[model samples]
Target: MAHASGMHSLEFKLPDLGEGLTEAEIVRWLVEVGDLVTIDQPVVEVETAKAMVEVPCPYGGVVTARFGEEGTELPVGAPLITVAVGEKQPTAGTGDTGTEGSGNVLVGYGTSEAPARRRRVRRERPVSGASATAGQTGAAGAANGRADAAAAPVDARAAGAAAAVDGQAGGPATEDGPVPVISPLVRRLARQNGLDLRELTGSGPDGLILRADVEDALRTAGRGATAAPAAEAHPRVPQTPGPALAAPGSTTAAPAEVRTPLKGIRGAVADKLARSRREIPDATCWVDADATELMRARTAMNAAGGPKISLLALLARICTAALARFPELNSTVDAEAREVVRFGQVHLGFAAQTDRGLVVPVVRDAHARDAESLTAEFARLTEAGRTGTLTPGDLTGGTFTLNNYGVFGVDGSTPIINHPEAAMLGVGRIVPKPWVHEGELAVRKVVQLSLTFDHRVCDGGVAGGFLRYVADCVEQPAVLLRTL
Candidate 1:
C-alpha cells in the first residue's frame, strides 16, 4: 500500500530464530516510533528460550509503528514493526526505494547490497467504510509531510485472504485460493490432526496460520463446541485434569491461585526434561572418590602455568578420557530405528544454572581439547550463560553431559539425562572427610561422582566401567597421564 507522498508501509515480522524456537519475549525495544533505522540495524532485543538476541531490522526507513510492548511474548512471523519507505528514505545508504532491504534477518548475516526483489505489496481493498477513511487520513498525513503518522491497523484476515488470492502468501492454489499458511510446522500439525487450514481464521498478522490456531481448532473439535462457549460454561476447568478449580462466581472463599505461564525457557526445560523421563529408562550409579590428588594437580598446574585450570575442566578432561574408554555411554538411541548411535567425536555439554533456567552449553569436539583448552571453553560458555549471550548453536548437539552441581552446595543427585543423549555425569561438592589412604587414616578431600545412563543403550557393566574410570582419574590424577 503506497501513500500519496510516494511512501509505502512494510511490515517486518519476527524472523525464525533457529533451533526450532517458536516464540520470543520482547525484552527491550532499541528503536521507538518514528525512529530512523538502517537495514540490519538492531531494532529490538528479544529473549528466546535458548538465549537473548538483538533482532535486526531488514528494512531501512522510518519506524512508523511498534507492534508489541516490552515483556509481551509474540510468536514467530508476528509483526514486529512497520517501516514507511519513500524515495527520500535511506535504503541502506542508497537513498533509492528501488533497492530492497539488506537480506539480513539475524545477526552475522546479510550484506551491504541486497538482491533487488519486489517488496510485499499490500493489495488495496476496502475492509469497511471506516477503514477507507483511516487509509485516506494516513495517506493525507504522509502527503502533508507528516512522516510520523502511525500506520492504520490492517484487517489481518482480509489482507491475508487478499494475499492468498494474489498468490503471495499461500500454498497450493485451490478454488478458494491457496491456504495462507507459511509455517510448515503449522501445516504439519494441522495435517497430523486432520484439520483443514482453509476452514479456520488465523489470529496472526496477515492472517498467517500459526501452531496455536491448529491446537485451538483441535481443542474445539474435541469438545464439539466453540471455544468461547466451552470456556464460558466451564471457566475454571483445568486443561490437563489436575485439581478442579473453584466454581465460577462462587461466594465461597478459596485460596488465590497465582499462576505463571510456563512459556519461554522454563517451558522448554519442562518439555525436554519430561520427554527424557518419559522415554529413557535411566539408572544412576554413584561412587565416592578421594579427590585430594585432582585438587592438588589443579593447584600445581595453576601455580606453574600462565592460566589457572578450573576444577570443572579437570573433571571434563577426565570425562573425555572415560568416554574414550567406553564410547557406549557417549551415544544416543535411535528409537525409530531401534539402534544405538554412538558418536566418534564427543561434544560435551555442561549444565549451567542461569537466571533464565537450567541450560546445557556444549563444547564442540571436547575429546580433542586438552585441560587448558577445556578450561577456556568452559569459562567462555559459563560467562555466556551468566550474561544470557549463549546462542542456540552453543546449547545443542551434545553426545554427553557433565553436570557440576557442587556449586549449589549439593552432595549428589541422580540427574535426568538430557534428552536424546545417552548419559550424564554429575559431580558433587568436594569437602574434607576422613579416609584411609595407603594403609593410614587421614582426612582427604572427597567428592561423589554419579553417572546416569539410559538402560537401553548400555547395561550396568558399561555404565559401571565408565564411572570407575572417571573415579580412578579423580583418585589418582596420574591415570590421565597415560591418555595424555
Candidate 2:
C-alpha cells in the first residue's frame, strides 16, 4: 500500500532484535494494506536464530505500504511498513521532524520518552512512489471500503527497485541523495564500530546496503590492522590473485559426499563455541554425589500438598546458592579492558534442545525466585523454547549456565563453556549405585556433577570448592536448608 501523492507517511524499518541478531525471516504478517492501526500494535512475526518474536509498528495511522513477503529474510533496518500518521491526525503539530511516538522501544531503534524527542522536527524528503500511490488510493479506497486496496496489492521490492532508479534511496551522499541504507541499526553499527560505509559495496538488491557488508569490512580492516605491525617489522611484498579456478573444463577426482550449510541458530552456536575454545583456557572437574536424601526430600515436600517442584528448578536453586558463595565463577573476562566483570544478580541460563537448535534461555535474578516460582518460570521458558516463541532477551544476559545433559541419559560429559560466561554446571543421571552408607554396603541414588570454569576467572581451588558444595547439597538436602 504505497502512499498516494500529497500523503505524508513515515516508513518504519525493522528494529534490532538483540543478542547480535542482525537479520530475521518474516514468518507472517498480521496487518494488511488500508488497515487503520495504532502505535505499538504487533504487525509482523519474525523468526531469528534463537526464537520467534512479533515486531510492533511504532506509528498510528492507515497502513499504506508493507515491504517484503512472508519468508523473506530482512536485515535490521530494512523497510517494514509505511504509515499515514500526518494524514490521520491533522490537529497535531506538523513540524517536519515531528514523528511523535508512544515511547516504546522496538528492536531496531529506540525512541526517547521525553518531551524533547517527542516534539522534534521531522526530516522532509521527496515522496516515494509507494507513498504517492498510497495517498491516491487510500483516500478513494477509505471512502469506498478499501475495495481498490484489496484488489491490487503493492509489491514492496518492485517499488524499492523503482526508488533506486529514481534516486529515492537518497540523493547524493549529502544534499539530495543519501546512502541506500534505510536501517538505523546498520548506521548505528557502522558508527559505533567506526566503520565507513562509503568505502564498501552493498550486496543487497539494486546496490542496496546491508549489515553483513559492513561487518565483513570491519573484519577485513581488523585483520589488516594486526598485519600492519608485522608488515612493518618484516618486509613488504606485492599481492597477486591466487590460483585461478582450475579452468572451467578442469576436473578432479573427488568422492561424493553430503554437505549441509552451517547457518541460522546452529551457525551462531558453532561460532560462539569455536571462539570460546580458541580464547578461553577452561578446565573441568567432576564429582560423584549420593543423592538418596535429595530425592526423599522432594517426595516429602510434594506429599505435603504444595506445588510440585521440578528437578531442574531444584538444581537451578542450588546453582544460584552456589554462585553466591563462589562469585568468582559468576563473571566474564573483558579482554578489551583487561578487567574481570562480576555480576551481583544471577541471570541463570539453562540449555534446552529444540527442533531448530540448542538454545539457552535465561532466568533473570534466579537468586530471588523460590522453588515454586523457579519451577513455574522454568516450565514457561521450556515451553517457549519448544514452541519457538522465545524472544532474544529470553536467550541472553546470563552470568552462568546450568547444563543438565542427563535428560539425554548420559553419565557425564566435559561440555564446552558458553562464551563470556565464566562457568557451566553439568548434571548427570541419578541412578542407584552401590555405596558405603551407614558403614555398610548399600544401594543409593547417585549422580555425577561436573563444573567447567574459565581458568582466568578462578583457580582450581575455587572451582573445586564450588563443585564440592554443589555435590554436598545433593547428598545432604539439609545442607541447602542452612542457607535458607
Candidate 3:
C-alpha cells in the first residue's frame, strides 16, 4: 500500500518575469490550499518589477499550500505555488508548464491567464412611447409597474411608465432617485430614441449600467402615456460614403495599407521598461581602462580553437567574478518590502543589437560556467538572438547584464541598468592610446568600461571597486585565471 501511494513533489519557482525584473508581488490567487490543480493550470498573478505576470502550475495534483498570498512579495527562485505529480487531462485555461521552473524564459515576455471569473448576462424589460401612452393615467401607472416587474430587475422601465401615466394625469411623475448606470448598448438604444441616460440603473457587474438597463428604463417610460417610438438606431452616423461596393464581376483592389498592433514580446518589453524606469532608483558610473590584456586573451582563446567570444563575454566572466566578491552588486531592489535580494547565481544578460532595437538575451548559470564554455554559450545565444532563433530559455534568468558599445565605434556610453539586477557593465571598443606601462608612457589597448548600477544597492566606493576589479581583469587576463 505504501509503495502504491508513491507521490512526486513539484516546486514551481518564480522565473524571470521580464524587463530584467527579479521579484514580484502576488496580486491574486485562483486556487486555495487543498484544492486540485492540473498541470499547466494558472495558479496566481504576480506583479513583477515591470508588469503583472500570471504564473502557471507545471504539474498536476493537489495544491498542498501556496507559498505566498495576495500582496506577498516573492523573489525569483522562491517557491511560488507547489503541485503534486499525477496524470490529469490537459485542460483549457491551462498555462504553459515544463521542466519544473526550468521552462523556456520566452526571451522577455511573460504569460497571461484568463480572468478568474466568468461574466453573467443580465436581463431587463423594454419600454416604448406607444406602450407608455396606453398604460398611463392611474391605470397606466399600474400597467407599467407590472410590465417592469415582468421584465426583471429594471426599475427605469417601471419609473418611465409611471411618468407617462402621470403625464396623462396632467402632471409629471414624481422624480426617482439618482440615475442608474446603464450598459453601453442600452445607452445607445435610448439615444436612438432620444432617451436620457440619467433615468436608468445598471444591473451589470458592480452595478454597471448595461444596455439592458437602459432598455428597461426606456420601457418603463413608455408604459402608460402615449409617446412616439424610440429611435430605431443611434442618432449619429457618418454621412461620407463607405468604400464603394465592388461590381459583381469586377476585381476589387484591397486597401493600399495595413496596420498591426504590437503584442507578445514587443508589448511586454515596452510595459516592463516603462515600469522599470518609473519604479527603480538608477545610478550610472563611467570609467576608461586599458584593455590590452583583454584583447590578447580574446585572440589567444580564439587561436586556441575555442569559440570566438566577444569582449562582452569576457566582461561577463569578469563581472561574475566581481559579483562573487561583492555579492551586493548582484542584488535586487524590493521597493514593496523595502528589502533587497542577493542572488547566489550569476545569470548575465548580454544586450544584443537586433533588427528590432536592443534585446538582452540572458546567460543562465554564468558564475558556474568556465571561460571556454562561457564563450561557446555566448556565441550560441547571441547567434540565436540575432537570428531570431532564441528559445524562451535562452533569454531569461539573468542576474546581471552587459552592453558593449565599442563595436559601433563609440568610445564610451553609460548604459541603462537592466533592472532588478543591481548593475550592468558596458564595454567599449579598444582604441590605441598612451598609457603608463612599467612607469613609462607607451601606446596600449585602452577600452572604456562603464558600470551602471542601482545606487540603492551600492555606493560610489563599492561601485568603483567593482569597476576597478573588472579593469584589472581586462588589463591582465591572467588575473581572471586566479579569480576564476
Which number leads on TM-score? Answer: 1
Question: Which of candidates 2 and 3 is the stronger one according to lDDT?
Answer: 2
If both were scored by lDDT, which would come out higher, candidate 1 or candidate 2? 1
| Candidates sorted on lDDT, descending | 1, 2, 3
As for candidate 1, its clashing pairs are none
Runs of candidate 1 exceeding 4 Å displacement: 1-4, 88-98, 107-257
The sequence of per-residue lDDT tens digits that candidate 1 reaches over residues 1-484 is 3343445577788898888888888765666654446677777777777776778788865565677766578799887887765544354434244457766796324555543322333333435677766764764454343223334433332334333222334443222134765343355456545688899999877988766787788776752211211101122333343266657543333324424456566678899999999999999999999999988988899899687888988998999999999989889999999899999999999999875679999999999998889999999998888766788889889999999999899889999999999999999999999999999999999999999999998899999999999999999999999999
Candidate 2 Cα outliers beyond 4 Å, as residue runs: 1-9, 18-20, 32-38, 60-64, 83-86, 89-105, 108-261
Q: Go through the candidates in order and give the C-alpha RMSD of each one to the true structure.
A: 14.5, 15.7, 20.9
TM-score quality measure for candidate 1: 0.71
For residues 271-359, what per-residue lDDT tens digits would candidate 2 score against the true structure?
88999999899999999999899899889888888789988888998998899999999999999999999998999999999755799
